[model samples]
Target: MTWKTKVNSALEGITGYTIVRPRPQAPPPKDTPRPPADPKIDRLLRAPVFVLSPVRSGSTLLRVMLNSHSRIHAPHELHIRRIAVSLTTEPVRQAMDALGHSPSDIEHVLWDRMLHRELVASGKDIIVDKTPSNVFAHRRISTCWPDARFIFLMRHPASIAGSWHEADPQERPMEEAVRHTLQYMRYLQEARRRYDGLDLRYEALVDDPEGEMRRVCTYLGIGYEPGMIEYGRHDHGEFVKGIGDWRDKIRSGRVQRGRPLPAPEDVPEDLREVATAWGYLQES
Candidate 1:
């Protein structure tokens, strides 16, 4: 690579550059003082909301509905928890040093700054990041932003355990499915207990998006708009890449609620207590 190319690639972690035209020999135009950036936007580091859940828990559906709102910029799966975790370590600092950037500079350029740009593009001020696996990273997020709010999206453990590749789990080992469900339950239980957030059930959301989203908007201190029901009218841009099951449903512009859950036996005995605690029945 040429020296310029090498330099650009090495500094790619830095913020994007802007170009300006040279002023001609004529006197420069009178300099008008620039307006101060909005204080709320300037300090919008903490996410307004995170739809934290496990796979197939209807997070995409909820995101589409919320994104349709005029003031909420709910985006697709960013998987930022992993990035959030990495940013808190020494390696991220070392990489920033190599790129001639500071820790906050690199982090701002990558995460909060990018989200703010997207939020502005969407003509919204609130950012709602929906990454299903973020349930496991609640502590990390809380540590970074003590006021981080979450929409703890959940489905019945048996329903999630029974779903994989859109396939019926009857042919697979039930133990493996139950194991995965148990882990998510543990995380959800802990997150619900530890954080300052809302617990929203996927079944309830899909059942009545209008009512659920109205409550959600009220919780987030935003007024509800009718446009949220027309989520399919918007282009979320690869919002369903890793979550294909939701693509058609989101595009259809209609709420698709979950079916009757599998028998209680589908959930492992150990997880029954969690299910009950979360308001799902323990019986088959």
Candidate 2:
């Protein structure tokens, strides 16, 4: 079986959320009353959010949960930061019709425009993007929006690696796991060093979504809403069908708390600092 199958099978065994693709649906009702907004929260809502993580680490699931909130527009991967990284001076200048803008400003324009459109269409003010590749663009995103929030979502190394191999079983499983896990850890470490945001573990989320999401709402300066846990059942947007089967369960429109599967060997000694920092290890 594909490594993806292993991950899907294990997750499916515990709770049964099946894959439901995003189809055309009526508008999501906006009847949730808004509480008084803090000026601090007002500022935060104006800034974009980059939900960073490696692929198949449950970022999509997190996005839907956050989107269940009254104001937050947590959408599927848009990879805005990736666009920032790919920009060149000349193209940016040309796009601006000779208007003066720093490279950072140009990238910000790109991010802002896309987010503005999405938020407008959704009738929500805040935009949360769950692009695992956004870690690549974190620096530029921060440069553009100094107050931007970075949420690092983490799953166990074993599950992440197993899922990776299942997506494409031809690759060397150990190398893929070690390389991607360490890379994600590096970004998480740097983000902790540089930014003020939350570091949430996937395990914690599945274990106690209410408590974990409450903590997240606190971090984001928003009140906790019980709707966040029932995100899977609501129609936030068209469901995203991604590579492999890891995301199918969340598409079932309800969060299913999965039973713990066997964990891979602890992270290697050299990388244990970050692994431990992210709550993935106790010791080297």
Candidate 3:
């Protein structure tokens, strides 16, 4: 071999050794797209009423009462916020890719299984999805299913903040909690302002559940049932207390949940005004 040929071979050998082939370039993965989002899911199974509220706003009690009517199915928090709009257009393949699984894999089947379970549990034509956080996605839902009726639950601002603090002591940060509470309140108000003929209802359901539930059923154009009054008496598993942790929190006098909660009279003047507007008063 020529001297130059040997040098070139040596250089090539070094290059090949150093630049390890990127393990047989896998065929450029075809653009695996997600399957179309099911339209049925978007319309909430064609349910007439869709409840939207902030957390701990007596929605659970509302849900139970709604379910008491044979024609109504009030499922626990459906968490439709992620699925209703955000993931609706995602292709099945893309969804699986996002979930790190094959689109048709049986192992990752739990996603649909659980989601469908909740969907199926909402037994009536009027399925009530009692997710409080869904307030954030109201506009998105409007875009996705404009015909769906939205029933918004509004609580007294002070009690709402107090309920948050009571449920999770860590939920309080003074400024942050206050800001979030105000933001949520504003969001609900904006929904009411923007949507014409919106089925928004305001009530402290916990205070007079029987009366409130009857009104709710009446608004939704559904029959009322007395069974709703005793939802807590049933074996609801994890949802037993529903959002009643606040009762203890309020009784304990922790500002938030575990912290020191202010009395209705003791609430800051500004917050107190907000609470009063919503019909909440201190227990005299």
Q: Specify the highest-TM-score model's number.
A: 2
Cα RMSD (angstroms) for every candidate in the order listed: 13.3, 19.5, 9.5
Residues 1-284, model 2: lDDT tens digits: 99977877777777666754457655423222222133242222366777777776788788889999988997767756556423334465466546544454455566667777888888877788887766766776676566678888877665666566676666756666667767765775677677877888888898889999999889888899999998866676676455212456866877777547544354445455655676667654
Put down candidate 1 lDDT per residue, 162-247, tens digits, no spaces.
66424555555667767766777789789988877888998888788789888998899989997887777877667446743445
Error of 1 at 194 (Å): 0.4
lDDT measured at residue 157 in model 2 versus the true structure, 0 to 100 = 60
- What candidate 2 gets wrong by more than 4 Å, as runs, is 1-45, 84-99, 241-246, 259-273
Could you arrange the candidates by TM-score from highest to lowest? 2, 1, 3
Number of clashing residue pairs, candidate 2:
6
Clashing pairs in 1: 264-284
Candidate 3 residue lDDT tens string, 1-284: 99977776677787445433345534324333232254444233343356777665666656666665676777667665454212223375476668554432322133344444664764545666667766776665564455557787776676666666655676575555566676676676667666653343335354565676677777778777777766654333344344322253223221221223346666655466545544466433
The model with the greater lDDT, 2 or 3, is 2
Which order, best to worst by lDDT?
A: 1, 2, 3
Q: What value of lDDT does candidate 3 attain over all alpha carbons?
A: 0.55
Per-candidate Cα lDDT values, in order, are 0.69, 0.69, 0.55
RMSD of 1: 13.3
